[model samples]
Target: MKTDTVKQAESAQINVITEESKQVIYKSLLSALTIIAISILVNLSIRVDYVLLGSSLGETSVTETLQLIMLAVASWSFFLLSKQKPHFAHAAILISGFFAVLMIREMDYWMDMIHHGSWVFPALAVTALACAKAYQGGKGTVNEMATILQSPYMKLLIGSVILLVVFSRLYGMGSFWQHVMNEHYVRDVKNISEEGIELLCYSLIALSAVRTHRELKR
Candidate 1:
């Protein structure tokens, strides 16, 4: 009877822990979703303004939206990492979050280039990194190789190196690069491409959210 009682207590404790974890995860998920929604709305507003006014009324909207998105992704990623057992989904969220943060930080620089009509190369480079990271994370390649290659750390290093090279090349372009970098890159990219990139980023966030929701349900 005592043994049975002890087992029941242990089970109860585990249940409590499980419930606590679920609450934390759910809160994080909620936070991310809310932030992402706000960002999307902000971007949409900016695009509309650009189309109608032919002026950058909400020029800073994109930067603000990106910042919110980065925070949202980071919260979700941390929540995933705190799960019972870390999974590929967690890694995906983490990578996406980190990349988002980097992009957000460099938004000012990109905008400067856009204003000066020289933001193409850096913008393309950012797009490339986002696509590559999302693909790798979604496919589980990063998770699988993490054990052998030390995974996330290695991947981060590689990404940083790639960005360095790309940026260096852009800088080496001399006067043109200087002109582009000094101008606001955000205002320079065609409205269509700006909208497209925003959409793509949102899609990636949604994908991550879906995966996390599915995992939690299971």
Candidate 2:
């Protein structure tokens, strides 16, 4: 009778632990979804603003918006996933977010606003330090990392970033639209470029999702 009672207690404890784990996973997933959604929204807003007003409003506006979104996403993802999947989700968010912040600084440089452009590098540095702690004995899943790295969409996204970096550097300190415009024709090439880049980023993210779904099916 005592053995049976002990078995029942063990089973109950297992059930309770399982339930708690599920709740934690569910919350983490929800938070990740929210952060991703907000990042998408911020990217959309930058695209829309560029479409309406061009870069004449200054790339700083778009840079600031993007930075805000990255900050929120990184903070939330780090908090929720660091304990669960430290190497995969936590490290990915931290690295990606810090990279996004660096991109913002690049934008500031492109706009010739060096004085007001001090935070991004420091933020990235701090994230780097935190990463050493967060990923200390954690190793990411090989299959998941392979799945992400093998996606064709990721290749295209990487190519696009390379192109944008080159283009932005070559045309420094002035709006692309301003350079393209003449007294007779006011062409807004900057808007078109910004919108195209935004679409490409979204498409890459969607493609990642599709790739994961396909992998699950197989």
Candidate 3:
């Protein structure tokens, strides 16, 4: 009877730890966005260090570098996660592959520099198909995917991700927005909003990956 009680206590403790971890990643995500928004606002309003931070907040700037680094880290995280947890092998592999494509997309300028700009779309399509194949053929992939989709937290985050992508595309076409918004405001928002939101999203994903790795470790 004592041994059974001890086992029950251990299980409850594990459950508490898991719930705490879930809260950690989401809190980290909220903090990420708040910090990014504050930083952007400060950068835009400050005039003292304008010379130094002027272009640091723009294209090929700190945000871009951070994006590359975070996405690469996420890819590595998922690749390692797959090796560590075979039950999630297929889903992890697909996520890793998708992030790899994202990294390439983020470095589109470099591709153009090498005169390979035209290859991006086709390459992206191929990678998407490959990931789809992995999902369709790998055992247990459907169950894993269903689990993710069924999680309310994941559903909310995934929905935010989709919305963010749509917002990015619309903001990227700044000229179209000028007719509706003040030209300067449109330009400024277009310049900063996409990168700002993207950075927050990447930070969230990276933190989530770190959390997943820790959970799987135990």
Question: Best lDDT goes to which candidate?
Answer: 3
Query: On residues 115-202, what C-alpha lDDT tens digit does candidate 2 reach at each position?
Result: 6656566656767765664365355534434544565545654564564456444543245556566554343455445544543343
- Model 3 clashing residue pairs (backbone): none
Full-model lDDT, candidate 2: 0.50
Q: Each candidate's lDDT (Cα)?
A: 0.50, 0.50, 0.65
Q: Estimated TM-score per prediction?
A: 0.34, 0.41, 0.66
lDDT of 1 by residue, 1-218 (tens): 57988999988887675767989999789868865875676567566656765545443545445445644654454345435335544354454455455454445555565575345455456557645654655656465336323532344334433544464344344455447656544443444344434434443444444444354435
Ranking by lDDT: 3, 1, 2
Consecutive 10-residue window with the lowest summed lDDT within model 2: 208-217
Candidate 2: the clashing residue pairs are none
Clash number for each model = 15, 0, 0
Which segments of model 3 are wrong by more than 4 Å?
1-51, 56-59, 118-122, 125-136, 147-157, 180-189
Q: After superposition, how far is residue 204 of candidate 2 from its true place, in Å?
A: 4.1
Residue 20 of candidate 2: its Cα lDDT? Answer: 73
